[model samples]
Target: MPSSKDAVIASLIKSFEAAPRREQPYPHWYLEHCLPTADVAELTALPFPAPALGGISGKREIHNATRQYFDAANMEKYPACKTLNEALQD
Candidate 1:
């Protein structure tokens, strides 16, 4: 029997591979039901450190050239963030 992780990976691969794509303007596929509602809620609830802005306007790329939103340290700090990352990668 396939492990739960393997089964999910297989399912995701099948769904993504089977989805129709548009190649005219750009190549993109619209996938659905990839993540569960509860998982989404938990991920969103994770306290990812807010990006520090340079000026009054909330622009991350204004003075800060480095565009590091989800860093490795933060991922280790937050399990939900890591879970979301793993789901996206799968």
Candidate 2:
């Protein structure tokens, strides 16, 4: 069985991947703003979307909101999975 850390990591990766690719203002904002808070050198080593989202730009508020969304949704599944599915349920 996958270790808890591995499960969490896999879940996180899956959550990220399963997320809709269609760009939204919120994610775009996170990509822009939160990236700076991430490691610059470390981010540079990654590729594509990771690098894109890992660098600084703008939209910090939006990023926070996005995080909140995830936190609400995956409270059970991941504790911070975001309630995107719930939002869609409405």
Candidate 3:
């Protein structure tokens, strides 16, 4: 059986691979732009906590942190994100 950490990493990879590629009507533009430039290899190289078997907090933290990084990097482009952010901010 794979160790817990291995299983977690595998699951994360699977989830990313399985995520649908459909575009959102008003997509998160920062994410859309950043993904092509984002270094998945570098990200996977970072040390992260082993995934929790039952709790979502671990995954949530990873997701939120990545979002924050993308948001900060793309803040200047927020004007372009008008439609999506407006709906989200309300």
Note the Cα lDDT for every prediction shown.
0.59, 0.36, 0.38
lDDT of 2 by residue, 1-90 (tens): 112333444444555555555556555311222222223333343332322345555876644533423234333544222222332244
Q: Give the distance in Å from residue 7's predicted Cα in candidate 2 to where it truly belongs.
A: 0.6
Could you tell which candidate, 1 or 3, scores higher by TM-score? 1
Provide the lDDT at 70 for model 2.
Answer: 28
Total residue pair clashes for candidate 3: 0
Off by over 4 Å in 2: 1-3, 26-90
* Model 2: lowest-lDDT 10 consecutive positions: 29-38
Q: Evaluate model 1: give its TM-score.
A: 0.50
Instruction: Choose the strongest candidate by lDDT.
Output: 1
Poorest stretch of ten by lDDT in candidate 3 = 29-38
User: Which pairs of residues collide in model 1?
Assistant: none
TM-score of candidate 2 relative to the true fold = 0.25
Best model number under TM-score: 1
* RMSD values, in order shown: 5.6, 16.5, 15.6
Q: RMSD of candidate 3 to the true fold?
A: 15.6
Compared with the true structure, what per-residue lDDT tens digits does model 3 show for residues 1-90?
112333334444555566655568753322222221123433333344554445445455555533433244343443223322333344
Decreasing TM-score order of the candidates: 1, 2, 3
